[model samples]
Every structure is written in structure tokens, then in C-alpha cells.
Target: MHFELRDYQFLKVKQYLKQKFLLFSNGASQTSTNWLAVEQSLSKSNLKYYKVYNKIALKVLTNSVYNNIKQAIKGTFFFLKLDGNTNLLTKQQLFKKLKSVFFTLLSIKLNNKIYSIVQIKKIKSLNYRSNMSIFYQFLSANLKCVYGITYKKISKQCDLNT
Candidate 1:
């Protein structure tokens, strides 16, 4: 899933950071009276907090469709055209090559001084046993090292370790 942030929203975020405001929110809704009271109390103090509403629309694709598009873009089929032998590389070797390629694509450069702050929510929604879940854990750890990133599971019903 991908999200596109508008230029205006980016400007608003910049403005908030410039003003040194602490941002707080409980997802999309602010119906919780206790949270609102906390916000109000913080507003009265020197340290102020602004309530932010986030609206996210996700587009999900199945594994087959996603893999087809990825392979097409990456031109993985070019190998088949060069040599008709698809078994030139063993399954283990192919897996290792793909893993390295993905790691290279996802690696962050520390030379760049700018850092991004990322917040991931509802992580418990993902299947814990899936390879995608392990990939996310690796990605979260990688980003945490180079950038300010936080993972939050809002629901108290599930454990993060699971």
C-alpha cells in the first residue's frame, strides 16, 4: 500500500515543527473525552500539543499481481530471453540474490544529513507468521537506526511479540 501526501499537508507539518508544537492524536477520531482534556491541559501549559487527524487510503494488491508488476518493471524476464534455461540458478541461489537485491533497494544512505520521522500504526493487523511480517520487522529496525521511527499497535487485545 502507498500513500501520497499533498504539498499543502507537507507545508502544514513544516509549520507545526517550526512552531515547536507537540502533535498528538488517537488515530482519525478525537471522541475520547480523556484525551481531549489532556490536550486542553497541555494547551494551558508552556508546552502545547496540537491534535492531528490523519486520513489514509490504501491500495492492496495480491502477491501474484504485485510480483508480475515488479518482475516486469525490473526486467527479470530478460534472463529467460538471453538463455532458455530458467534453472541456471538453484532456488536457494535465486532466493539469496532476490534477498540481496531487496536489501540493497531498501538500504538507507547515512551520508544524507536529512532524516525522516516515520510512524507505523496497526502493525498487529499483519499476519505474524508471514515473510512480509519479518520483512517489516527488518525494515522497522533499519529505519530506526537512521531515522526517527515509531511502531504502535493501538489495540490492546493483541501482543506485539506475537
Candidate 2:
């Protein structure tokens, strides 16, 4: 089934991504409250993330697009110190590479979200119990790491097995 993210959820994702480089939503498909928590966390952080829709790549550069690209190039040059490896790139080549990176980033701005949807679909379609269990185990482990919580300890504190 096809699904579209709601506007608030989309905004939440943007804010979350700005403060955090990545996001992973947990809970079954029936539960969307997890995303609400994510949104709240994002709001608290005052972070704003840029979104790039993966399905649509800009083929033409309108004035605004051109200006954005120019700003991106300038920002890249400002933040990126030229290293010895730059010796391998002529000024023209470096400019080309930066432009390439700008377009690439622009094209995949929503890549992580797209990829997450794809992964969620795969997880939902799984029929094998063992496979689902294994996937959940892996996800839980990763979540523990991301949250800096020791699952074993928490589970024990809650009187549950690790």
C-alpha cells in the first residue's frame, strides 16, 4: 500500500534531522505516537533540517535554484579547508566537484526518509517469524546504542529478561 507522510510528521522529520544526522522510528504500523515523541524532541532542540525529495530531481535551474546552488557552493568552500589532496584537483575541477556534491545532496535530500519507508515495507511484508524476531532484535540493539541505554540493565530494572 502507498502512504504519504502528514505535514506535521514531515515537519518533525525536518526538525529532527537538523539536530540529528539520522532517525529511526520504532513501534508497529498501528502506532504513530512514536513519531510524535520524535517531533517533540525535535521541537525541544530547535533544529531545522533540509528536505530533498528523492523522486524529484531538479533538471532546470530557475533563478532561486541557481541562487541556492551558489550559496551551497560558497558555504562548502567556506567550511571546507583545502587540503593537500586539493593539489590533485585544479580550481575548475574543484568547483565542478562542489557543484556535483550540491546537486547530489539536493537530489537525495529526502533519501533517508525514502529509504526508511522502503525498509518499513520490507519489514511489514516479512512472513517468517524467525526473520521478524531477528530483525526486531537487531533494531532493539541499535536503538539501545543510539539512546545510550543498556538494554540489559533496563530490562532487568523492569523485572524483565534481557
Candidate 3:
């Protein structure tokens, strides 16, 4: 979650970016480790890959990353902001979740209230995140209707009684 520090306010730009990224990557369960890299890659995939990261892949990453981040961190010190403000939490929980997100994206696991994001291994020959085809899965997920909308808009629309 990157943000522009305009004379000190730590505005919620990071939160908005974080939320939007999660919404876009809601399929694969992206851990907190490499959170920033994934975001940077997806944001600049056009330059990096000549196109936006696959919407389905992006949505998977967003959902997994955000969910992982939220669970590790509390639920107060956090609020989604986009131009205005959608603060629906406190600072403590907010910080915790964001921290967790970064760590989790990096593939770290939470243990005993402490984060351990350095013991990840790469020898598991397991099959994951590849079972579902992008076309069918995303189509079933309604990738067309909410395409290109910002996270804020998505959230607003997702809210009940709207």
C-alpha cells in the first residue's frame, strides 16, 4: 500500500490502493510477502507485460492479500479511503492489518502474535492457483459488469441496501 505523503497526513491513499488492488486480485491466495511487488507489477503490468495483469489473477491476489492482511492485524486502526474518506476502523487495527498484508504478501506466517515471514520454502511440488481457468472462472465471477471500477465504487455497490 503506497501513498503520497503530502506535508504529513498519511492520507488513506495507501488504503485505497490496497483495497483496489485486493478487489482486482480476488482469486489466488496471495500471501503478505511480496505484496508490494505484486501490486507494483499489477499496476505497471502494461509496461511490464504490455497489459494489465489478468483480471482474474488480479482479483485473486487482491482478495487473498487483503484477507490475509486483515486477519493478522486488528480491525480498528484501519479504514478504506478514496479521495474522501471511508474510515470504518481505528488506528491500531488498521496498522496491524497493513503490516500483516506486507508480511503476508511476502509469504510470512503469523505465529504467537509475532510475524515470521522469513522461513518460506520453495520445494513444494504442489498444484495450486492453476486449477481454474481464467476465462470460465472469471466469467462466472462476473468479471464483465464491475470491470475497470475503482475499489471505492466496488465497495459502495457491494454494500447492501444501496
Candidate 4:
């Protein structure tokens, strides 16, 4: 499945951040209710927590991929060469790669509620596993790292353990 990032989330947050900062100054990032505040604001914008999560996932993944390939020849032409069903990952490591990607994601943001698998199926042609499994893989892979341990080792280990 092909998926697109709904800018609805970032736009909502960016505007909210602008407003909060307008009122509260730079302290907004450190606001006591940061997570709840973001969540509530998103919901108010009619973006479910899941929708924001899915869109964020889509944005991060697409941008990561686009950056990696943006310089390789004409990007649009190159991208069109592949099967839309053929995801960015290699054939052998679909699950492991997805786990690695999500591990990176949750580390940056932890409060996501698992939404649709559309963001995921778009990542690999493989139907893949549940987002909960992806989350477990993220946590189990990183529980030991104090934010800097190599995800390289963790992801490989996760692939093996799974």
C-alpha cells in the first residue's frame, strides 16, 4: 500500500506551538502538560492521536527515503522505476527493517497510539505485523540505551530474537 503523510498533524502542532509560545513564551516546550497538551490540541483539531501518529510515521519514513535517494539521478524518475508495491526495504528484512524504523520513531516520540497499518504497509510490500508488535520491538530494542546506544545493534538483535 502506498501512503502519504497528512500534513494535518504537523500543521496543527506548529500552529498550536506558535500560539502557546505567543502566550507562554519559550517555556511551552517544557510545559508541564506537554504530552497531554499536544494530544488534546491534536484531538481538538479533529486529528485523532492515531491519525497524528500515522501521519508522523509517514512523514518521517518518506523524508528519510527521499533524502537518501534525492540526489540519485532524477528523484521522480528513479522513484517511478520501482514497483509501487515494492517498498524501500529489501526483500529479506521487511519485518526487521520496519522494527528498526519504528524503534527510531518511538525514541523521538513515545505517546503514539497505534493507528492504521497504512503507514506500515506503505513501508514494505509485506503485509507486516501489528503496530503493537512494532512498539514492543521498539521498546525491547531500546530499553537499555540511554538515548544513544546504537540502534544498529539493537535492531539486529531484535530481528534475531523475534
Candidate ranking (TM-score, best to worst): 1, 2, 4, 3
Question: Model 4, which residues run further than 4 Å from truth?
Answer: 1-68, 74-76, 80-125, 128-135, 138-162
Which pairs clash in the backbone of model 1? Answer: none
Q: Name the 10 consecutive residues with the lowest summed lDDT in model 4.
A: 19-28
Query: What is the lDDT of every predicted structure here?
Result: 0.31, 0.36, 0.34, 0.34
Q: Best candidate per TM-score, number?
A: 1
lDDT against true structure, model 4:
0.34
Tell me, by lDDT, which candidate is best: 2
The segments of candidate 3 whose C-alpha lies over 4 angstroms from its true place after superposition are: 1-9, 13-19, 23-70, 74-103, 106-162
lDDT by residue for model 4 over 1-162, one digit each (tens)? Answer: 544445655555344322211111111222456656654543433322222243443344354422231122221110001123433434244334323222111211112222223443344332335545776888977886645566777888999999
lDDT of 3 by residue, 69-148 (tens): 44323221222222223324333443354343432232222221222233223312111233235446768668655564
Q: Which stretches of candidate 1 lie over 4 Å from their true place?
A: 1-6, 19-30, 52-162
lDDT of 1 by residue, 9-124 (tens): 54454444332112222222335785565445433332333322232101111222222222112211111010222314332442243333221121111122211112122222
Steric clash count of candidate 4: 0
Q: What is the lDDT, from 0 to 100, of the residue 21 in candidate 3?
A: 15
TM-score of each: 0.22, 0.19, 0.16, 0.18
